[model samples]
Target: MVSTPLPPADEKAVWVRSMFDRIAPRYDRFNDLLSAGVHRRWRARTIDALAPTGGETFLDLCAGTMDLAVAISERAPGARVAAADFSIRMLASGREKAAATPGPVHPVAADALALPFPDAAFDGCTIGFGLRNLADYSQGLAEMQRVLAPGGRLVVLEFTTPPGKVFRALYHGYFHHVLPRAGALVSHDSAAARYLPESVKAFPDVRSLARLLREAGFDRVRYRYLTGGIAALHHGVRP
Candidate 1:
């Protein structure tokens, strides 16, 4: 299936940025339809995992419309949160919603592979459902490590296939079939909907991702399956 290219490389960046720009208007609705409102719950769970304490600074990489950034703001009303993404339209969409949260939620246009901020600039890092689309997950992880202060925590929430054969079969069917159709109907962007599952299907497993995190200079790397292994959350601390 033909779909939007991945990011960082010039062509892929252009394709991804354009795709997200087109979908920015429908993204929230698209997500609601794609996950049947469960994505919100998953995001809420991710914020809990992020464990934002008031007054701390956090960065949301690949922030995509700022769902998690808003969650972080609401959860820790005094925290300063920066939501970074390469898609200008997506960042604009997020900026429109920033007023709802008590704390500051700044939408910054930045790529994950080469973040624009200084080293050790944030107290925590959070990325949700966005890691798979990075040009190189390892480089992205390293960038995350670079921006986080020593002992800063990084939390990642992403879709993953189930391990059990029977469950994997059912999950693959939904990912390849039902989800894309639902996504297309909501976003009216069939190529992106098709790319969603295809990209995630090609991504590294949760265990491999944990190793990559460790190799990228993060300590205490660990992961846990969510939603019967349909998604996973990985957490680590900067060394």
Candidate 2:
């Protein structure tokens, strides 16, 4: 199913920020409800792909409530993980999760399109389910690449359209119809929750996204389908 065209770039960014702010308080909980907590499994795989060693500085763009940041600190205790998001409310929520992290995971209020970090400042970067919400997906990918040191890996975990006809049909129906309602029930906001499936439907397929990553100056771009392509983990190295 196709979604209506997105608004102008500036307008869409403002809308997405406000939408995330409105739901920040319960965002993590609603995520569990929507994915039945299986997102943790996908994220674990993403961390493994990231393979953060000691003393590296990494970023979690579109970090939301900082689940990945916390996990990164847990997995690589000496790594410095910074979670950056446009939503201040989401950053505030992320701060709470930092207390439990093994290493320091700082929250930064930053935009992905124009990241505040210097070029090649980070050892690695990860964007979890947040790339699709960007008004300009390709630009966002490039910006992530610009922030990473040459040869540093970039891992992106995101929602994707399933490739199989039978699975796609079933997943599409549940995503648009069931998932939104389930999210609304969890967060008490239907419209923002409804935007979830709309964004996913509008995102490019796995192959297209891989090509976009390569075009964005990332080499050796590859993707692995998760849960039958209901989501995917895409990885690349900065060149």
Candidate 3:
């Protein structure tokens, strides 16, 4: 059975920031455990699709703990990465991680709805595990498109429900039950953990999300499902 979307009440950006702040300390650890480290591979694939080379300017939105920021910097030594998140705690944690990385990573506190950058400021933008949390995914997508230079790319990595009947049943059980319990135990934020599954359930899946990207002024929207459609990496280009 398909899950109904959660109430729109919790979709506010302020609500999202508060929830993330409560789990900032253990967020990365929980992600590592929850995805069984497959998140790393997924991120690598997303970055590989972007093909960021030296001298490029990249933006990592909702960049909690700077995982994507550090990875992009390492992958492209000369690349300058600006990682932004609305949550101060998450941004602080990300800054701490960025400081230890060899390449340049700038952690900024910014809102996804109103990115504090000039139009066409970035050569590319990435949002890893962030889209589902946005109050207005379409607005967030538009903001990313606004910041990207013409011909620049945007890569989004987000969780989605699996397609197969048996797999969907198993995955839903894990997501709705096991994940929340495990995440709450690790992150010490029961509400945040509970919100995770609800948020993913509320988000548009691969095909619908790609259509949203196109509506947001991106061209050549495409997506690749991973882990039996549990997650997807979406790519789009600014024309």
Backbone clash numbers for all candidates listed = 0, 0, 0
Candidate 1 steric clashes: 0
Q: In model 2, what lDDT does residue 157 have?
A: 96
* TM-score, cand. 2: 0.96
Q: Per-residue lDDT for 150-233 in model 3, tens only?
A: 999999999998988999999999999898888879988877888888888878978999999999999999999988999999
lDDT of each: 0.87, 0.90, 0.89
Among the numbered candidates, top lDDT falls to 2
For model 1, how does the per-residue alpha-carbon lDDT over 1-239 read when each residue is reduced to its tens digit? Answer: 34445444546656777889999989988888777788888888888888999989999989988989999999999999999999988878767678778999988989888899999999999999888877678888999999999999999999998988899998888888887887898899998898888788778898898989989989898888887888899999998
Better of 2 and 3 by lDDT: 2
Candidate 1 vs candidate 3: the lDDT winner is: 3
Kindly state the number of residue pairs that clash in model 2.
0
> What ordering of candidates by TM-score runs from best to worst?
2, 3, 1
lDDT of 1: 0.87
Q: For this target, which candidate reaches the highest TM-score against the unseen true structure?
A: 2
Could you report the Cα RMSD, in angstroms, for every candidate shown? 1.9, 1.7, 2.2
